[model samples]
Structure formats: structure tokens, C-alpha cells
Target: LPSAGSSRFAAAVTQHAPAFKGTAVVNGEFKELSLDDFKGKYLVLFFYPLDFTFVCPTEIVAFSNKANEFRDVNCEVVAVSVDSHFSHLAWINTPRKSGGLGKMNIPVLSDLTKQISRDYGVLLEGPGIALR
Candidate 1:
């Protein structure tokens, strides 16, 4: 993973995904998670721009609402952003009508260091956030 402000970025995730481990908010609880946790299953790893946003919430909640469907097919859904875990929890606690992520069924991770975003080729290096 790229260090903070590292120049090595935007190389694209051409090979296997760069492994990552970090704090995540899952079902309104904090947990330690890593890419390895979803082993033996199809992993839908998605990266968003921030915790509190307009379009971002829709995508997060849509995937979250459809989490069971993914699980039925033996897959796991995980969302990542450059925001802190606290922010993710707060968003989950908020209602969807208010533009919060609301009751996330999938795990939402905190990429405060932005390493995951960087490794995935979604990091906006200038602003230090994910692209999608």
C-alpha cells in the first residue's frame, strides 16, 4: 500500500488486489478486517469518495440493501472510503432520507490513510480521496 502522500499511484490494479487491513464499521459495530477475510468467496469491494455525500450514499445504500442477494451467491460486499471509521458509523446511524448511509448490511471501511484507494487506482492524489 502507498504511504501518505506517496508519489507512486494511479498504476491501476492490473494484477491481484493489493492486500489491505484496517478498522471497519460492520452492522453498526467496529471490527478489524482485511482483504483476506473475504477469502473463498466473491468479494465486491467498492470505493466511494467520502462518508457524507449525495451520490455516494445511493450507491452505498443500494449495495447494502442488496447485501443478502450477494450473500446468497456466496459473495461479500464491502465499501471503502478515505473517511474515518467514526464517520462511517455516524453515517450508518443516520437515516437514508437525510442522505446518510443508514443501516449498512455490508462492511464499511475507513481508509483514513487512503492506502486502499491508492492501491486500487481510485485515489485522487491531489485531493487525497477516492474517485468512486
Candidate 2:
């Protein structure tokens, strides 16, 4: 991850994804996750600003609703946010109408350290959050 004022802050599209390890909410349970765990398969990872916020649930749910589509092409979807695993679990347990993820098929990961978001070049330094 680049520090503030670093000129190289953007992630390279064609390169391998940066290595990451963290706790993630999976099916209402917390589990350890790592980038290497998905080796040999395509990964469709995305980062959202945070959990239980505007547009975040809608986007994640839309991705979850198309789980089969990703699977059909041999890919797995993973969503990341600056929130903790507990927050992810809470949102997953809530209903969609109430700004929750609602039975998401994809795992919602917690980048609590903000390192993953920074490494991915999506962290918003001013707000201490991620950007999409």
C-alpha cells in the first residue's frame, strides 16, 4: 500500500492482485480469508465504501443475485470494505430493504486495517474509507 503523497497509488490492472489476508463474513459466520486461497481460479473482487450505506447494499446485492453468472464462467465474487467482520455479519443478517446485504452468496470481507483498500488503490485518505 502506498503512503500519503506517494506518486504510485493506483493499482495496475494487468498484474496479479496484491496479497491480502483478513477476516470475512461468510454465511453469517466469520472466517479467515486470503488472496492465495483462490489461486488457480478467476476472482471478481470489488470494494465498497462501507456496509449498510447508500448504494453499497444495492451494488453488492446485485452482484450476489448474479452469483450463478459468475460461477458459470468459473469466477468467484468477493466484496471488501473498511468495516469490521462484525459489521459485515450484521448487515448480512439484516433485510435488503433496511440497507442490508440480505443473504449474499458472495463473501463480504473486512479490511479493518485499511491496508487492503490502500493496496488496491481504492482507499479515500481524507475520509479513512474505501471508494467503490
Give all candidate RMSDs, comma-separated: 3.3, 2.8
lDDT tens digits, residue span 45-117, model 2: 8999977788778889999999889989889999999999998998899887787778989889999989888
User: Which candidate number maximizes TM-score?
Assistant: 2
Q: After superposition, which runs of candidate 2 have C-alpha atoms over 4 Å from their true positions?
A: 1-9
Error of 1 at 22 (Å): 0.6
Over 1-132, each residue of candidate 1 has an lDDT whose tens digit, in order, gives: 453334454443444556889999987999999989988998888999887788899888899899999999999999999999999999899988898877888999999998888777788889998887
TM-score of 1: 0.88
lDDT of 1 at 47: 91
- lDDT (C-alpha) at residue 63 in model 2: 92
